[model samples]
Target: MMLLLMLIADLLILSVHGWIVYKTTKIECFPNARYIRNATCGIKAVNRYRSHTNMESDIVNKLRNVSLNLQIFLRNSANKFKPFLVNVTANLCSILDKRNFPAYTTIVMNILKEVSNVNHSCPFTHPLSTHQQKRLIVKNLYMDEKFMPIVPPLGLYKIDFNFLEGYPYDDVGTVILYIQVTDVKEFKLRTKAPKFVYSTIIYKTLSIECKYNPEILTNVTCQLKPINWQKSVCIWDADIPHSLKNISIHLQLFKIYGANNFLPFLINTTLNMCDVLSKRSFSVYGKILFTILKETSNINHQCPHEEHLSLYNLYVDARLVPVTLPLGIYKAVVRFLEGYPQVFIGTTVLNLEAMEKRERRGKVNKN
Candidate 1:
C-alpha cells in the first residue's frame, strides 16, 4: 500500500508542475488584463498622431495661400515710387524634431528699423497662422536695417517667408500691407511780365502739384495758396476803371521801366501816328513833351529832368527819356499834340521811383 501511494503522489506532483508552466505560457500568448490595457493605450496614441498630422497639413495649406496673396500685393504696387526692390527672407524651423513642425505654430511677423545700429522693434503684429497643436514653440529672427527705406510712397508691401534659404515656398508663408498715402495740389496767380503792374492786364496761369505722395494719382486736394497779394498777378483792384477817362484816345502808355536803377526811365507810348501819317504820306508833324517832379521838392536842379520825346518814324511811335535822379518818390507828366502850337490832348503820370521803393522794401523784409 505504501509503494502504490508513492507512485500516485509522484504523478500528481508532475502534473501540477506542467499545469503551472502551461498557465504562464497561455497568459503570455493570449490576451490578459495587462495586454488589454496596453492595446487600449496604443490605440489612443495612434489617434492622437493622426489628429496632429491633419493639423500640420492644414497649416501647410494656409501658408501656401499666404504666399499667393503676397505675390498679388507686390504686383499691384510695382509701379509705385520705390527706389529699389526690398526683399527679406527667413527660415521657419519645426519645433518638434521627431516630426517636421513649426516651433511657433502661430506665425507672427513684425516690421522694424534700426537707429544707429540698434534695432527698434515695431508695434504692429502680423498673424500668419492660427492653428493650434500639441506643442508650441518660437524662434527669433533678425532683420537687416538696409531694407528699412525700400518702401514706396504709396502701394502695397509684402514680406516673404522662405523655407529654402532665399527660395519661396507655400509651406513657409508670407505677410502683406496695403498702404495709400495722401495727395494734394496748389495754384497761384502770376504775371507774364518781369515786374507786376496794376495797370497791366497780361497774366500767367500758375499751377503747382504736391510731391508728398507720388504713387497715388487720384483725389488730389488743393491746399496751398498765395501768401502775398502784392507779389501775385491778380492784385489789381477790380473796381478801378478799365479805361483811363482823361487819357488821349490816340496815345496809350504801353510801358515804363528803367535800367535796374542805373539808367533813366524809358516811357514808351503807342500812338496812331502810323494811321495819322498814312494819309500825310511823306512826313508826320508831332511833338511829345514830358516833365519830372520830386515829392520832397528835393529836385536835383542840375539833373536834366525835362525833355522832349524821341519820334521813331519807322514804327510810328514815341518815347520819353528822363535823366537819372536821387532815389526818392518822383512822377512824370506827358503831353501829346499835332499842330505847331502843340494842342494838349492828354497827359499821364508815372510813379516809377515809388514802385521801385516798395519793391526794395519787400525784398529786404523777405530776406
Candidate 2:
C-alpha cells in the first residue's frame, strides 16, 4: 500500500508542473522534455517585460536614422503619431482596429524596447546642444476637425522645429528637433558613444506654470534641465497635461492612411484658428504645406470651380494646385485653421471628388 501511494504522489506532482509550465510559456510542452525545453523558453515568456538599456552613441545614431526616415514617410501618410512604441508585452493598440496586425505588433514591440533603452541615454546636457536633437516627449496635445485624438501612426511624432544656432545647423540658424521615449516607467536617461567613451545625458527642464490651458501652450520657454531618464516617458517625471476642451498645439501627430486623404486635410485653418481660439499659425516648424486637387475638374481637388476653391475652401499652402496636379501622390498640410472649433475643420463637408492619381508625381515637391 505504501509503495502504491508513492507512485500516485509522483504522478500528481508531474501533472501540476506541466500545467504551470504551459501557462508560463504558451508553447506546448514536449514529451519527456516538459521540464527541459519549457524552462529555457519559459524564462523568456516570464520576462516579457525584460529589456536592456543601450546608450552607446553608435547604436543610438543608427536608431535615429531609422526614426528620421520613418517620420518623413509617416507625415505624407497621416497627421500624427506617438514616437517610439514602448510597453512590451502589452498590446499597444486595439486589435479590432483595421490597422492592427500580428507581424507589425511583434516588430514594433521589439523596436520599442530597443529605442527606449537607447533614448534613456540622451548624452547632451543642452536640448539645443551640438549634435544633440532636442527630444520632444510631451503629453500629446492636438485635436482634429472631428475633435478626435490626433495620435500619429507607426508611432512617428513630429517635433516641428527648425535648427537653432551654435548647433549643427548654425549656418542656417535653423534648429532641427527630434525626440525618443523609454520603455520602463522611471526618470533616468542614459547614452553611449563611439571611441569607447561613456557619457551621461542631462537636461534642465521647464515646468507647466499653469495647467488651466493645456492646449493653448504659448510664450513659454523650455530650458532643458539636465535629466536622468527612468523607464517612464516623461522627463524629471514632469507630468504631461491633457486637453480639456478643444485646444491648439503645435506638436500635432495623426495616423497616416493612404486610403483616406480627406482625413488629413485642414480646411480654412487660419480663420478657424483666429476665430475659434484668438490664435494664429504659430508653428516655427515651417508653414502648413498641403497638396490640393479639384473636385469638378476630374482631378483631386478642394472643389470643382474657382469660386469655391479660391473664395471659401482653398489649400492654405500656396504651392498646392488649389487648381490641379499632374495626377500623382501629393501632400496637403494646411497652415492654420482660423475659425477653428466653431467652424467645420476639414474639406469633408464639401463632398469633393477624387482624382486619385497613382503616378503623376514620384515624390512631393520639397520646395
Candidate 3:
C-alpha cells in the first residue's frame, strides 16, 4: 500500500511540472490581432479557441475594409465640394453676425489654411507703377506639406486683405495685408501664362454710420484693388490752388475702369489715388513749322496744331517759379471730387533730394 502511494505522488509531481511548462509556452490567439496578449488554455480546448479566433478575425477585416471605403468616399465628396468651399470661405465675413467678428476671422483663416498650399516666403515686393505694362503672377503665399498633406482642388479663390496696425495717415505709409487666390481648373493654362479674373471690390467704413462715407475707411475696408482688369483711360484735369495760381496741379487718377467705355460710369474713387505732380504736360508737347510750295506764285503754309516758341525762334526758357515749402511732406488734399461723399485723394512719397540730403563717401582705402 505504501509503494502504491509513492508512485501516485511521483505521477502527481510530473503532471504539475508538465502543466507549468505548457502554460509558460502557450500561444495566445485573438479574434483581432490587436488584442492578443498573455493567454493559456489546456490542449483539449486549443482547437475550439482557434475556431472562434478565425471568425473574429474575419469580422474585424470586414469592418476595416468598410472603414477604408468610407474614408475614400468622403475624400471624393470633399473634392466635388471644394469650389463651393472656396466661395463660402471668402464670403464668411459677410454672412457672420457683426458682433462675432473675432470668431468669423478665425474661421475664415482656418478655412484658408485648409484649402491653401502653405508658402513661407516673403510677400512679393514689386512697387506698382502705372507707366509700364504691369504683369503679376498670383500664387499661394505658403506651400507647407505638413499643413497641406493633399493638394487642394484647382478653382478660383477670392482673397481679401486689410491692415494689421490700423489705417496709417499721411507721411506714414500703411501696411496692407495681401491675400491672393489662384485658379484651379486653369492650372494648365496658368502653368504656361497667368490668367486674369474679374472680381468686385466693395469699400466700407470703420463704423456702420460711416458706410455712406467711403473716405473713413477702417483698416478692414482699406485695400488695393486687383490690377488684373484692362487699363483705364487717364484724363488729366487742371487744378489751380489758391496759393499757386500759375502752377497748374495735374490731377490724374491711376486708370479708371468702365469710364472710357461707351457706357457712362464713374470710377470707384474711394479705392483710387488721384496723384498730383508738379511736372507740366506742356513740356512734353512739341510744335513744328510747315511750308508748302503752290503752283501759283504765292506760297502757302499750314502750321500743324498750335505752335509753341522753339529754339529756332530764339525763345528763352520760362522763368523758374519758386514755390517755398517747409521741410515737411506736403500732399494735395482733394475732397468730394469724384462724386463720392468725402472721397479724399492723397499723394504717395514725393522724394526731394535738396531738402533731405545724404553724403556718400568711398570706403577707406588700405594702402
Candidate 4:
C-alpha cells in the first residue's frame, strides 16, 4: 500500500513537471495551444519518470508465478488425503483335544499395498463360544511375527493352533462351527468359511439279546457311558415274559438314530435270530424287538441297530429270572416270546431314522 501511494505521488509529480515543461517552453514556442490531454512526452522518459525501479511490472509477474506455485502445492497435499487401507480376516476355532495344537495362528495376507499402511490382524476367537464353553483363553498370539512389527505383513504367521482345520471332530457332537477367514471386506459364498460343527452320526449303539420271564422282567437303569472308547450300541433279549404289560413297558426304551441304514438289517437279523433261538419247553417262546436311543453324542464309531437284540427261554426257574437278567429298566429288553408270561405283541424300529436323516440333511442344506 505504501508503495502504491508513493507511485501515485511520483506520477502526480511527473505530470506536473511535464505540464510545466510544456507550459513554460514547448507551448510558448507553439502558441495555438493543446490541452493537458493532448500534451505528451517520450515513452521511455515518461515511464522512467513515473515509477520506482524496484516496484516494476517484472515484480507483478513474479507474484503471479508465486501464486501458481502455491496452487500446485495445495493440490499435491489433497492427494495425500485419499483413504487409509486395512485388511481383515475371519476367525473360528473349536478344539476337540486340548493337547492338539492349531496349524496356523494367522493367515497369509495376500493384499497388495501402495501409498498407505496395511494392517493384517491376528485371528481373534469369538467371545460367545469362549464364554459358553468357559474353556481356556487362547494364548501365544502374535502382532507381526513374534508379535514384532518388523515382520513383513504380507505373509502368513504360525497360529500354533489355527482352528480352521480340514479334519473336524466334535466334542459333545451337537453342533460344530467352522470359520473361514477372508482378506476382503465383503463375505464370499465360495470361500470355505470356518465352522465347528457336528457331523451327523452315521451310526449309534451296538445290540445283543437276552431272554427272560415277563413276570420277572426287571430293568436296572444304568448310565451308558463310553469307558476307554468302547461302545455299547444295543442289547436284545426275549427270554421269558411275566405280564404282557412288563414286556411292553420294559421294551419301550432302546431307541436308534438314522434308522434308514441299520433298522431293516436289525429287524431281519433279530427275527431270524429269535426263530432259531431254542426255547426251554413249557416256557413261552417269545421275543420283543427294539431300537436303542443314545444321542448323547461325540466323535466315535458306533454301529446301528434296530433295537435291543434279545433271547427268550421259558420253563426255567421262575425265581432265577430276576437274579439272572433281573429287570426294572435294564438297557436291554425282551419283547416277544410266544406262549411265555405275556402274550407276544410286535413293534420294530425298522424306519426310525429314515425321516430324521432326511430332515437333518434338509436343515443343513447338504445338497
Candidate 5:
C-alpha cells in the first residue's frame, strides 16, 4: 500500500511540473504619466510606441539637491485597481550610502541599477543631460525573460513611482506605469497564421490631394483616377526653375478615429530625400516609397533638379506596405523641404482605406 501511494504522488508532481513548463506568459509595460507640482527643477517625460515600446524621462536639477526620496506602489485588477497591494518607500541617498542592503531593498536597488546610472555611492554631483537620461531609460527599462518570475494570474497591474523632497517631504512628482500579463495559449488560438504575412494585407487608395508653393513649383497638376474595378493611378506633373541642391521629406500616417479627428498611426519619419535618391541610406518606410516610385517617376536619380518632373499613371502597389497594419481609414501626409534651412516647398495628402481582398471583391460586386 505504501509503495502504491508513493507512485501516485510522483505522478501528480510530474503533472504539475509539465503544466508549468508548457504554459508561458507575456508582460508588457508602458508609462502612464509624470506629474510634477510647482518646483524649481524641470522634468520632461514622453512615451512612444513604434516598432517597439519606449519611455523617456529627463530631469533637470537646477536646485542641485543631493538627497531624494522614492516611493513605489503596486496595484492589480483584483479590486478594480483601487487599492494598493504593495507600498515601498526608501531614501535613495541613504540607500546609496549602504554597502550591503537588506532583502526588501535589494529589489529596489536592482531595478535602479538596471534602468539608471546610479551605480556608485551617492553625493551624485554631476548633472545628467536629457540625452543621457533618454538613452539609459529607453534602452534598459525592458524586462528580461530570465529575470521574470513564475507566471502570475493574468491581469492588469499598475506601478506608481512617487518622488518627494525637502524636510517636510513634499511631493515632487509621480511617474505611473501599467503592466499587462497575458497567456500565450489564448494568443495562439486567435491567430491562425503568422502576424506579418504579406499576402494578408490589401490596401486601396481612396483619394489624393496635392498642394505646392506656386513660387517654387509652376505648372503643377496632380490627380488620381481609377483604371479599372481593381486598379487606380496617380498622375503628377510639375516644373522647377531653380536647381534643388538638398531636399528632405517628412511622411506622417494618421488613422481617422471619428469625423475630423485624426490620430497618429504607425509611420512618422523625416529623412533626407537626396540621401535616399543616391542610395546612401534608406529606412523601412523609405524602401516602400522607393519601390513604388522607381517604376513610374524620376525620383531614383541623384539630387540637383532644374527641369520638369512627371509621373504618368503611377500605381500605388498595396503589396509594398507593411502587413501588420490593420484594416481602417488612414491618411498619409508627405511634405517636401529644400535647402539647408529646410523650406517647405510642397505637400501631398492621400486618403486611403485597407480591407481584406475578399471584402473588397464583395463590395465591388455589390456596387
Candidate 6:
C-alpha cells in the first residue's frame, strides 16, 4: 500500500513539473529608447518607437574608439527600481574584435546583425549617403527567447546603454531599453500574437539598359519602357548563331558611390550557361537568374547550337530581388562567352536602381 501511495505521489510530481515547463513558453523582452543625445560635430542621433513595441535608433556618422556602459535595473518590492544585475563598461571596438563580456556582447551583436548593416568587425562605419542610409536600418525587431544566452528572473527590468567616445570617454549617446518577462500561458491569453512586427524587404527598379555584339549575335534589340509611373518592362530579342555551343556567362555588379562613379560591389563571377540550362549544375547565381527569368522568358531548356533567344515584356519582379540592396544607381555587366577558350560572343550592360517602396494610402505614390 505504501509503495502504491509513493507511486501516486511520483506521478503527481511529474505532472506538476510538466505543466510548469509547458506553461513557460518564452521570454518576452521589448526595447524602448527613452531619449538619445549626441554632443559631437558631424554626428546625428535620433530615437523613436516605430511601432508600439519596436524601438529604432538612427545614428549617422562613423564611429571609432567607442565605449559602451551597460546597466540593468529591476523593480524592487518597495515600489522602487534598483540595480539588481550587471553594471559593466567595456570598449565596443574591443568587444567586436575579441568578444569580451561574451554574455552581453552576444546580445549586442545579435541585435545589430538583425536590424542594421553595421559590419560585425570593429571600427563601425555606416552608410553615409542619403539613399544608403535609408537601406541600412530595417523595421522588423524582436528577440527570440532561445537567442538569449542567459535569461534573467521574471520581472520588470530596464537596460541603459551609455555610449562614449575618445580617450577621455566623452559622452556620445544614451539609449534605454525596457524588458518584461512573463509566462507563455499569460502571454497567449492576453496577447493576440507575438508582440513584434515582421516585414519583408521591398525594392523598386528605376531603369535597365542592355548591349550586345552585332557580329556574333545578329539582329540584337533591347528596350525598356514604362508600363506605368511605378512599373517598367524590359524586352530583348537576339539571334543566336548556330556555331555557338558550350556557352558561358560572366556577371559583375557595381554600385554608384558618389555622383556618376560606379565602384565594384559584388559578384565578378562566371557560370557555364549550358550546365545551368541542362540541369547538370545549379549554382546560387544560376538559381537567382532562373527565378527572375523563368516566368517570362524561354531560356529554361537544355543548351546546344541555338536559334533565336528572346524575352518579351519581362517585368522586374520586386519580390524576386533576394537581398536588401542600398538605394542608388547600379550597373550589371553580363558577358556571353563561347567554347572553352571563352571567346567573347556578346556583352550586355544593364543599368538599374533600387528604390524604397512607398506605402499605398489612397492613391499610389512613387518614391
Best by lDDT: 6
Q: Best TM-score goes to which candidate?
A: 5
Q: What are the per-residue Cα lDDT tens digits for candidate 6 across 1-367?
A: 1111111111111101111111111122222122121211111112210111223233444456777666666666786667643555667677667656433555555555554454355454344636443222322344444344223344556666666667897665554544454334443454355443223324334566665666678888887877765567778878877656688988877778767787755446677888877777656567667766577777766667567888877765656544445567778888889887767787777777666556556875777
Instruction: Please write out the lDDT profile of model 3 over residues 131-154, one tens digit for every residue.
Output: 121121112122222222112222
Clashing pairs in 5: none
* Model 4, residue 228: C-alpha shift (Å): 4.8
TM-score of each: 0.16, 0.20, 0.15, 0.16, 0.49, 0.44
Each candidate's number of clashing pairs is 4, 69, 9, 85, 0, 0
Q: Where is model 2 more than 4 Å wrong at Cα?
A: 1-110, 113-272, 275-280, 284-367
For residues 1-367, could you state the per-residue lDDT of candidate 2 as single tens digits?
0111111111111101101110111111111121011111111222322211111121111111111111111133455543221111112222212234332333333333322322232121242344433221111111111221111222222332121122231211111122221122221222221122112221111121112222322232222232322111111112213222332222221222467543332211222222122223322121222112231112222211111112222322323212221222223322222124532222211112223323334687879
Off by over 4 Å in 5: 1-199, 359-367
Residue range with the least summed lDDT across 10 consecutive positions in model 6: 7-16
Question: How well is each residue in 153-191 modelled by candidate 4, as lDDT tens digits?
Answer: 121111111112122421110101111111332323333
Residue runs of model 1 more than 4 Å from their true location after superposition = 1-83, 92-151, 156-177, 183-367
lDDT of 6 at 173: 57
Candidate 6 ranges beyond 4 A from true positions: 1-205, 359-367
lDDT, residue 329, model 1: 33
Q: CA lDDT of each candidate? A: 0.21, 0.21, 0.19, 0.20, 0.50, 0.52
| Cα displacement (Å) at residue 332, model 4 | 12
What is the alpha-carbon lDDT for the whole of candidate 4?
0.20
Candidate 4 positional error at 25, Å: 99
Task: Score residue 179 of candidate 1 by CA lDDT.
Answer: 24
